[model samples]
Target: MKIILPVAGKGTRLRPHTHTRAKSLVQVAGKTVLEHIIERLKVLAADELIFITDENGQQIEAFMKRVFPDLNCSYIVQKDRLGPAHAVALADPRIAEGDDVLVVFNDTIFVTDLTRIPELCAEADGLIYSKEVEDYQRFGVNVIRNGIIVDMVEKPDTPVSRLAQVGLYYLKDANRFMQYLDQAIQAGDTVKGEFYLPAVFMRMVNDGLRFRAPEIDAWLDCGKPETLLETNRYLLEERHSCQGDLIDTVVIPPVFIADGVTVRGSIIGPYVSLATGTTVEASIVRDSIVNADCQVKDANLRFSILGNGVRLAGSPRRMNIGDDSLIEMDS
Candidate 1:
């Protein structure tokens, strides 16, 4: 199977953090968000991993080379700022007609048994992974009928279906999907000056192409700040361990304290993540994410996000400080 990841979008929702770095490269639970996504797909043993990046995608290449040197990956830069279909279309030269392409978006971190995908999609034309969400209006809902997906609605006004289309899809015929995508582009099938994947997929659905909408276990979105923290909490619940055995610090379960993280006389977590080179002294931190090279002292930080190289002092009960920012609160 060939894997495709369209990661060229500018994360406007995750500003301040995304202002300095790519959204996917942002640290969560002591590791990058991209790392978390890639770790889940390592068991699939795909043929080649392709990343559709942008011009300033040097950081992505460097990180991937350093972390996954032997993964057999390739990178292609998408110059234009088009939609997801445009980004995926840029990789057309690399994929063949019979190749099975698995397209996964970078904004989401999914938790499901990806090892069983090959066996599950053996007889199907394609697979569209979704999650059953209550707030169906916030996401694109899939209309399934007779055990197959017949239609896809984008953020419907009414509750047509509860199956939210989680940005994960498996295309059995790469060539056919590309052909349809091209047709949509040629036909000016766009929504507000941008081409959408749902339009192309709906076209295919009309042509009698069967797509099985498989419900995924978890769909953790990292698009915004609140959601990003929520995703971090979910990840910590599944996989988290302290590399450093703290003595004076009040360590809590389900928290990730990376190596070189100094925690002195502080009450941390039930849900907290601290990266390396960070020092927390005489503080009580919980439900927060502190990046690397930060210093927090005499603080009561909760529901806070201190970016890289940030310094927090005094008694900031709650915060949303950015990178390299020095925040002094009222004691």
Candidate 2:
């Protein structure tokens, strides 16, 4: 089976962080978001993998080469931010003939092994991972009838179902998917003039193509600032021990502290991750995630996240700061 990972999005929602770094390269729990996706693919024994990226493609390729040396790797540059369907269309030449293809969004991280997808594809045209969410209006909602996807409403006012597509898809016939994509583009079936992959799926459904829906275990979205922090906390909490150092602080459970870190007169988390070369002084950090080479001093931080090389001083009531920032509280 071949895996096509569309990582071409600029991740505008992430703002300054994605401005300086690739969204897929963002680290959480001592691993990049892309790494977690790749690790899950390894369990599925996915033989070939294709990544669609833009300017950051070179760096991602280099990293993949170092980590997945034995896997068949290829890259397709999405020069235009057209849409998801356009992005998947770029994989046409990279995928082999008569091969099952799985197109997974880079921002969606699945905690369970999707190895059964290959077998599932053998019995279905395509399989989409679906999960229940409280707010269906924020995502593409699906309306199914007797195991068939009858309709799709993107951020609808009133959702018919709580199931939302988690961005994991398997297509047994690449040619069929490409044909629908072309038809949708020609017909101007797009969202804000940008062709969406879901449009193609709907087209397929209209043509009597059967697409299955699979319920996933854990589907995480690390595309936003708050979601990134929450995902980091969840990943850290699952681990046994995190790597970090201490100076003179009371460390608590579910915290990850990297090497060369010094904490003094502070109580660190029930769920916190401190990166290397970070220093915390005379403060209490709880339910927060601090990236590499950061410093926190004389502040009470709770349910917050700090990016790399951040320095905090003074005594703020609460904080939610980004990377490479110097915040001095009102002393």
Candidate 3:
């Protein structure tokens, strides 16, 4: 099977931080968003990994090469930036005929047992993962008949189906998928000037392909600033470990302190992640994520996110500060 990741999004919602770095590279729970996604993909053991990135996606390429050196991966440039269908279509040359394809979006991290994939695909034409969410209008919901997905309605007025597509798919016939994707693009079957993968899947559904919508274990979105922090809080529960020896520092449970992090005269945690090279002194920090190489002195922070190389002093408040910022709050 080939794993295709469309990671070319500019992340317009995650401003400031995204202005200087890719959204997938944003740090949360002491790991990058892409790293967390790669952790999930390690179970797949795919034949070849294809990343659809933009022309200016060198940072992603470099980070992947440096961190995941042994990965058998190739990068495809999505020049037009049309939509999901266009992104996956760029990998057509890499996907051979009849090869199984797993398409995953990079803006979110999902937890699903992929061990049953091969077995499930053997019986079905495709597989879609979804989570039952209360906000049905916010997503394209799966319309299921009996046991298979019959249609997908985007932002329906009524609560048709609570199963929201969590941006993960497994197609048994990659060649057929590309055909539908091409058809969607050529027929001008676009929402607003961009082709989407859901339309292609709908076309495939109309042509007698069976798609099973399984219940996903979890779907953690890192699309925007608020969601990123929520994802951080979620990850910290599973990855709670500290590699630091501090003095005059108090640590609560469920926090991640990376190596080279210094915490002195402070109480940190309940849900927090302090990245490497960060120092928290004379402060009380909780429910937040502080990125690498930051200095937090004489402050109390909560439900905040500090990007890399930020320096904060003399404050007690919440923030969404970005990289390399220096803030000296009033006493």
How does each model score on lDDT? 0.87, 0.80, 0.89
lDDT of 2 by residue, 81-164 (tens): 888888888887766667777888988788655767666656568887788889988889778887767888888788688889
Instruction: State, as a TM-score between 0 and 1, how close model 3 is to the true structure.
Output: 0.97
Best by lDDT: 3
- Number of the candidate with higher TM-score, 2 or 3: 3
Give per-model CA RMSD. Answer: 1.4, 2.2, 1.1
Over the stretch 101-187, how does candidate 1's per-residue lDDT look in tens digits?
Answer: 899999998988887777767767888899999999999889999878989999999989999988899998888888888998899
| Candidate 1: residue 124 Cα off by (Å) | 2.1
What lDDT tens digits, residue by residue, belong to model 3 across residues 190-301?
8888888789899999999999998888899999878988998888889899897578888997999998999899999988999999999999998998999999999989
Flag regions of model 3 displaced more than 4 Å. Answer: none
Error of 2 at 231 (Å): 1.9
Candidate 1 wrong stretches, greater than 4 Å: 245-247
What is the alpha-carbon lDDT of model 2 when measured against the actual structure?
Answer: 0.80
Q: What is the lDDT of candidate 3?
A: 0.89
